[model samples]
Target: MSYPAAPRRSAVANAIYGLLNPIPFGFFVAAMIFDIIYAKTGTILWVKAAAWLITLGLLLAIIPRLVNLAQVWITSRRFSTGADHVDFWLNFVAIVAAILNAFVHSRDAYAMMPAGMWLSVLTVLLIAIGHVIIAVRYSTDRGYNHV
Candidate 1:
């Protein structure tokens, strides 16, 4: 028996993925660090920065999420890895946590404490796992899977 050759992403898709994927992660990681700083220093600047970073991360995540949706949901049979669904859910949950973190950060500095920081930790953890899934699961011969 023979298997199909791997589905190759268009250069545009690859370009978009490569370009956009790291940005939100960077923002979120930065936000996480800021949250930690806030926890350590009890400084309002750190919390406010964390809020901005979370908001920016959410905004920046939209495009890459769309790309992943196109692959994991719309074209699963054609191109998505089995683990893509896991990746999608992980990112989706992380985005949700970031949204909650943003809302929490809207409160007074100390009010947002702990909760916002925890949410940031959750978001970062989910995204990190999602990134690992993409790295481990995607391959030419590994192919695709259905939902």
Candidate 2:
């Protein structure tokens, strides 16, 4: 007896995903951390750094998102796993949060205040959830079982 093979991304898609997906994650995480530091230190530098990091993350995120969108939704619907779908939505919301945070950061450092910090926190939280969904997609060797 054989288990049905789990729907999987193509090697090229996987490579593209592996390469680009983590970039935004790192950026968002760094931004969040910087936001926290800025909150504590009240330093303009940290806030400026956070803004740049968030902007860069959003820009890099576009490539993989477009590619994944083409593969997962446009090309064909071969994916059976729902995790990617959940992740997509989570990341979408996260990106929006990051965008808003970016605009907030554009204001005077002191003015950005709690709202920018909160937005950064929220963005990182959402992206982390999305990452968890991808991480949990294949915890077992057998992707799925049939009875």
Candidate 3:
């Protein structure tokens, strides 16, 4: 079955995505900072953990939509750019980072919920599977190759 071409990466979208790209990264940083701060102060660990979980959840939810838009951009005939593997890799990396942050944040001295720890591990595994999907699909495309 054929799919519609990906829309061009508009200046607006580019700017937006570019700005948003730091989110996962920032979450990682924030998770670390919060952990260090709270671990030292010995207060509000649960609150920090909650914030980290919220960030992780938001990143997981929004990344798919961004990736879909990127896929459309890559598949579009007008762009003539067939390789979306790089975009997929970036998504994989971002999700992996977020998951790592979640895992790290869940190890707090205050209270580490087993459910959150397991969920982060599952998210990491799922993102790895997504990497496999990108690799398999791109390998079959013949028009794309690993860089």
lDDT of 2: 0.86
Instruction: Give all TM-scores, in the order shown.
Output: 0.88, 0.89, 0.42
TM-score for predicted model 1 compared with the true structure: 0.88
How many clashes does the backbone of model 2 have?
Answer: 0
- All candidates' lDDT scores? 0.87, 0.86, 0.53
What's model 2's lDDT at 44?
A: 89
Position 138, candidate 3: lDDT: 53
Which tens-of-lDDT digit does each residue in 1-147 have in candidate 1? 687777776678668977998899999999999989999999889889888999999999999899878877875446776678898899999999999999999999999888988999999999999888777766434655557
Whichever of 2 and 3 has more TM-score, that candidate is 2
Where in model 3 is the C-alpha error above 4 Å? Answer: 1-8, 46-73, 76-87, 96-147
Q: What are the per-residue Cα lDDT tens digits for candidate 2 across 1-147?
A: 777866666788879988998899899889889989999999889999999999999999998888777766766456635886788788889889989999999999999989999998899899898888777776545456667
lDDT for model 1, please.
Answer: 0.87
User: Between 1 and 2, whose TM-score is larger?
Assistant: 2
Error of 1 at 131 (Å): 0.8
Residue 34 in candidate 1 has what lDDT? 96
Return the candidate ranking by TM-score, descending.
Answer: 2, 1, 3
The residue pairs found clashing in candidate 1 are: none
* Model 2 TM-score, all chains together: 0.89
**lDDT at position 40, candidate 1:** 95
Candidate 3 residue-wise lDDT, 1-147, digit = tens = 576754555666557655664455444444445544554576675446645554765564475446456645554436533345454555556465555545555465456444444444454455445556656765775455569
